[model samples]
Target: MDLLKKKILAEGSVEEGNILKVDSFLNHQLDVAFLNEVGKEFKRLFEDREITKILTLETSGIAIASIAAQYFNVPVVFAKKIATKNLDKATYESDVYSYTKGRTYKIKVSKKYITSDDRILIIDDFLANAQAALGLMDIINKAGATLEGIGIVIEKGFQDGGELLRKQGINLKSLVIVDSLEVGNIKFR
Candidate 1:
């Protein structure tokens, strides 16, 4: 994950309110090569797990999960933040409060996409407040699906998200953990 760390240092910007904007390569502008490396790392990390499907939130998590799904040979299911006509009425739902957006929103997934017998691996771009992760976990639990593990590209270690998930006995792997973002200085753990 050294390449990812280096890329973060080179292109990531610490914005106001401690938000680390990685739009240059991660969420906004796509970095296929770097993302391929990310996929490889995630596959290596969760290779031993019985992962039947990859779960993620919509928008930012879509690309990472899609690329990683290739390595796992599983379908990627993303929770939709916006309700659509195509989405089934019978869905697993959860509420997530976005610290960055400063509001709570409901995320939903069709029941047909997930089942009780499947083992799910959650993937996302970042882990900060754990709200999104917890929300996704709730959906997985509602479906009676087993959560095999969580793969995060970058974790804000200064926050309690990673610690809380770990305390809950989740097998969480973060490629690069930022211990501090004080005064716009990025400190990694």
Candidate 2:
């Protein structure tokens, strides 16, 4: 995790209101080799659990989840941020507040993907307030599936998302946790 922490300190920018913009290597353009390491770390952290599926949100979470799925040998299912015409009416839906985007949106997942028999591992690029993670967990609940764990690439420890999920007894793992981002300085937890 030191390498990842180092990458964040070097390339990540701290915007006003405690947002860490990792668009260069994560949310926008991706680094495949770095992602592979992330996948391996996730696999290692959750080795004891039986992960049948990898669940994530659309757009940003897709690439990270798909890459990690290769390590888990499980199928990746991403909840769509926008409702599409082809989507079924019987799908599970949840609304999430995105701090980075400065808006609230509904995310949906088809009911056919998750089931009672599956153990799901949620993966995403970042976790600040954890609204998206909670929304995804809600979808998993609606499908009657068990949440195996959550694998976050980067977590803002200064926020409440990680603590909130931990308080709920959900298994959460963050590769690099930012304790503070004050005046362009990155502090790790």
Q: Which candidate leads the pack in TM-score?
A: 1
Model 2 misplaced regions, further than 4 Å: none
After superposing candidate 1 on the true structure, give the runs of residues whose Cα lies further than 4 Å from its correct spot. none
Q: Name the top lDDT candidate.
A: 1
Q: How does each model score on TM-score? A: 0.98, 0.97
Candidate 1's displacement at residue 161, Å, is 0.3
User: Candidate 1 lDDT, tens digit per residue, 122-187?
Assistant: 999999989999999999999999999999999999999999999999999999999988555789
lDDT by residue for model 2 over 1-189, one digit each (tens)? 998988887788988888888888888999889888888999999999999999999899999999899999999999999988999788999999999889999999888898889999999999999999999999999999999999999999999999999999989999988899976799998
Candidate 2 global TM-score: 0.97
RMSD of 2: 0.9
Q: What is the lDDT of residue 145 in candidate 1?
A: 99
